[model samples]
Target: MKQDVQPLIVNVKRYTLVRNLVFGWLTVVLFAGFLLNFPKINILEHTARNLYFHVPMWFTMMAAAFVSGYHSLKVLQTGDPLRDIRALQAARIGTFFGILGLSTGIVWSRFTWYVGTDVWWNFDPRQIMVSIQLLIYGGYFVLRSAFDEPNRRAKISAVFNLFAMTALPFLLYVIPRQMESLHPGAEGNPAFSQITHPVMRLVFYPAIIGFIGLFWVLYTQRVRVAWLKYRVTQDSEM
Candidate 1:
């Protein structure tokens, strides 16, 4: 019992350190995001501010998916129930970021490109592919609930989580770029760096790091809580 409790103690200490650091870092990013000056392009003008907020959401989602995939791989190797918990938490958080990314993109696009029109969604390739990606992860959560046995659920869900991770990059980046898209890096559109001002990159990079750190903090908290519940109930679903 002491051995088990000891690991939890160490985890708590580490989590506390990271949580505080991420909070401070993100606070700074938020301030810089709004306060810093950016070059105004036609159409994008003020909405260019979204580069710091919107782009980071997808970056955070990618980071979360990577973390989830690593844990899922561990689950396959060690059959550790805790790995399943981590995978689930990471995927859930990743999905949250995906949703934010989609929402922000819609708002940004509506005002910038569809100002005179009533279009909220134009069925852009990136938008369609990302929506499908989110649905794939949605299936992962739903699949977990179908099994009553803990080990079986963990094993099966871990497999599905891996598949979801595999599909992420292609759906979010590759396929979207292959067809016509208003988004940067897509067919005929300039890549991000080509259109974005150098000054914006300063905030953009840190914003990515800050959002990913935020994801880690949230994911770790959920894992700790779920672990506690699992220990007490001997059930991995919390």
Candidate 2:
């Protein structure tokens, strides 16, 4: 009994520590993101400030994909229900970040690039690819719900999750760059490093770390809640 309780206590303590640390770290990133001075450029003027926020959303999504993929792989090997919970939570958070990224990109583009045209989405290659990527993950959730059995759902969804993860890099980064895009890093367009200022990098790097930390905190919190529900109801679907 003591041995079992000891692991729970340790997990509680570690979760508390990470929770507090991420909260404080993100607070700093928020302030630094706004306070840091950046060089001004035409059309992108103040919107350039979004570099600290908008870009990190995709980065966090990528991190979440990798985490979800790892857990899916474990579920295949160990057939652990807990691993399914982790994978589901991670994918959910990743989708959330992707939505945020798309929304922010729309807002940024409307204000800066499409000011007169009233166009919210220009069907940019990167934009289209990211939308497709989100749809793929959406299918993962749908696939999970198609099954009534816990073990069966976990097994099938884990396979689909792996395929989704495999397509993420290609959709989000590779194919986007090969096509014509308003976004940076497209064919003939300057990469981020070429256009970003040194001062912005200071905040940009920390912002990525902070947002990924935020993802972890949220993901872990969901896992704990799902695990508790599983224990009480004997239903892993929660």
TM-score versus the correct structure, for each prediction: 0.96, 0.96
* Residue pairs with backbone overlap in model 1: none
List, residue by residue over 76-140, the lDDT tens digit for candidate 1.
Answer: 99998889889999999999999999999999999999999989999999999999999999999
Tens-digit lDDT track of model 2 for 67-165: 999999999999999899999999999999999999999999999889899899999999999999999999998999899899989989999999999
What CA RMSD would you report for each candidate?
A: 1.8, 1.7
Instruction: Report the poorest 10 consecutive residues by lDDT, candidate 1.
Output: 1-10
lDDT of each: 0.91, 0.91
Q: What lDDT, from 0 to 1, does candidate 2 have?
A: 0.91
Q: Which pairs of residues collide in candidate 2?
A: none
Off by over 4 Å in 1: 1-6
